[model samples]
Target: MLKTALFGLAAATQAIALATIQAKGSKLFTSDGNQFYIKGIAYQLTEDDPLAQGDQCKLDATLMKTLGANSIRVYHVDPTADHDACMSAFSDAGIYAWIDVDTFSTYILPDNPEWNETMYDAYASVIDAFHNYDNVAGFYVGNEVLTTGASSIAAPYVKAAARDMKAYRDSKGYRSIPVGYSAADIADLRPNLQNYLACGSNSSESLDFFALNAYEWCGQSDFETSGYTFLQQNASDYNIPIYFSETGCNTPKPRTFDDQAAILGSDMADSWSGAIIYEWIQEANDYGLISYGPSAAATATNAVGGYTRSGTPTPISPDFDNLSNHWKTLTPSGVSMSAYNPSASAPSCPAFTSGNWLVSGNVPLPTLGDAFKASGSSSGSSSGTSSGTVSASPSSSRAGTGGSSASAAPSSTGEAAAATSSAAAMRNGVPVIAQWAVWLGGR
Candidate 1:
């Protein structure tokens, strides 16, 4: 314990007094005083996808660099995914990484240190493996770790783990990297964050800044994720800065890329320091602005940075229309990460037009744990500002509209393709508008 405490002390000194938090309304400052603006995509690092693994990686990275993309949110890694190749591509391309915590569906209890230990060991191993990379922004601890609202116990493990991980990184004398889990928004993560921070009287001490995956799906209204406005208003209590680990949105509403953007674009403008879209290739369903060449649904060969208007969106040979029209609502400059005050209390959102989205029979209120699984996903939090989010991870990804569901993500080759195909087919599986997917061509 003395060793752990000492280690913690040393680690704290390294990052303390440095004060760089990316909360709503605050500039996104890194531990190194670096101010960042994210413009990228959430793509797989699998060998099958030319954008990530093999020779295609060169093509993929080149396209991103050409287009203006500065980062790639790496998720779902396979054994043959070419880890070094992917990271190298991002690094050489000058792209940041919205790295995830391996797979998802984590709900380890604090008392279950054995379980916690096992998971943390693996989690730490990944962090250790990548922390040294300059391009890496930080670690995204869990993907909807509390989706089910089913964990009878609110584990303070995350807070404890954050401290332990920091110590582990520092004992060996390493620079501090931002670290935290990714929830769609604070409402989904409230349980975990609150419990994690409540570990001791000095709760905030355990974790670094918080991270959010603020992807607003279609049928959504003018709203930021639920707690962002609250956080902005109460920035003093939740002083921890927030890095948008992921913020994606589908476009064109029902068809291809609709010229109309979400009404919440203002919320994004005024509420974040860093955020990235989830795609680049203009594929079917208005997800990617360009296609990966082999998409069975789209074949419209659009130039790197093609359309900038609302007219017939150059289709990307997509298979389904499971997307929301978000790109249509940019602040004109596109990809705005500057901070602003929360809206004058957000009004009721479209998703929540109906009372409570979650079907009480399936998912009870005051969601306990399992941050990634919502049976009948709901929208809006009656507490003034409206914010509702859905979680997607390698283990299980959920869709928010009416019928939210979860499925284990594939980790191997054949299986991964199936997941990808299924995701493309289901259309509903579209990730929240990840604001970081724009495929960049130039600096």
Candidate 2:
């Protein structure tokens, strides 16, 4: 069996190499002729926290596989660790990975010969050690270095890092790997949009793709409405393709499963190069769909009410059923501006269970961990109104019939239990979420 797995890995690597992937026309395509909008979520190491309220059992990779998602943005890349096994899991499962360099400072300090040498060594080590991992798609050179611009800024590090790494790869005859960098959600947030966007030199050299991390905080409009379009316009001016590395918002609190899907799916459709959601697992701040709970969630009454951190999870998105409802209206229904109440803010929410430990203000949006608290204190009462019409208003938050609240956090465990109970429940007004679900089961 050991020999067979190794043989299978080698075969898989060859298959991945032979798989012709195209980065063209505002989207990507696979050899199988599948149109990829880069619909995916950022999976995290959050569940690894021993005291996390998450259900450990439900955190399964299979959930991502079933969602039709094509990629995952791993936040860290440590070459010496079991990264091969990590990348291999996704590779074998047919999921793409956008691996990130360990730190923002690494990319920014390239001008300093000493720091440059250190950064280069770390980068080269990972590229050389893990480049063979079939699932590795691209390198996310720097994270949000531009967000907190100052003497501490790391913009220069990018140019130097890219040059050094590319040179090293070429020296070793390393194969072609699509290179890229991500900007803080808004273009202006990045120190220099004009130059940063030029990281890939119009996708001609320094980079092959561009990434943006747009988070809709208290803004009345989707970031894409202003953010993506502006970048897309610039990319058009530069003739380069842009990928929204991360795009999501938190206005619909107690986020129903469908709402979760809608927020993520909408941005993907809105962007030209496609996008991936902030996170894949629940963190201290938000409910990541998958987790583990104690014992058998396989049975009905055996389930614990809340925060078991026990069962393995399966996730389902909030907007899983209402595919057309998402992002179709640039702003979500509950958090948009309106002619009736134009003065209303986008609505605020509380921090997660563990978030209390920090000095929390209204965070724009976290990197990829527990991204949001419940949508709003009003529980999505004041919906977001945008140029599009599908926006739901706060007046609609009432539960007209008997069931879950209109804005309950999406839960796959509920769906799983329902699944075993009867087929009739699934069809009879019960919401169905198409996203991933991992049952968290713990001791």
Write the residue-wise lDDT of candidate 1 on 1-443 in tens digits: 00011344364211112222232223344434445555556554231232234455666676566556666766533323325555666567766665654432232321111123334555566666565455666565544444433321222334445556666667767556666655534354343343343223342334555655554332343334423455344332343444455444443243332212322244443334445554544422234545544333223332222322112223343312222223322433322244333332211111211221211111111211112222233521111110222223221121111111132111111112111001101124432321111111121
Q: In the order shown, what is each candidate's alpha-carbon RMSD?
A: 15.3, 19.5
Q: Give per-residue lDDT, candidate 2, residue 70.
A: 61
lDDT tens digits by residue: candidate 2, 1-443? 01012454364322334243344333344544554446566654422221122232123445556555667776544455534344444555567767665332233321111123444565677677656655566776655434322211224334345545656667888555566676654333332432343433123334445676655432244435434445544444332345666644434543322322323444433235556665554433343444444333434343323333334554535532222233243332222112122221111222212311111222221111111122222221111111110111110110010011111123232211100101111224543321211111120
lDDT of each: 0.38, 0.40
Q: Evaluate model 2: give its lDDT.
A: 0.40
TM-score of candidate 1 against the unseen true structure: 0.53
Q: How far off is residue 426 in model 1, in Å?
A: 42
Local error of candidate 2 at residue 218 (angstroms): 7.2
Indicate the residue-level lDDT of 308 in model 2. Answer: 38
Error of 1 at 55 (Å): 2.7
Q: For each candidate, what TM-score against the reference?
A: 0.53, 0.55
Clashes of each: 62, 79
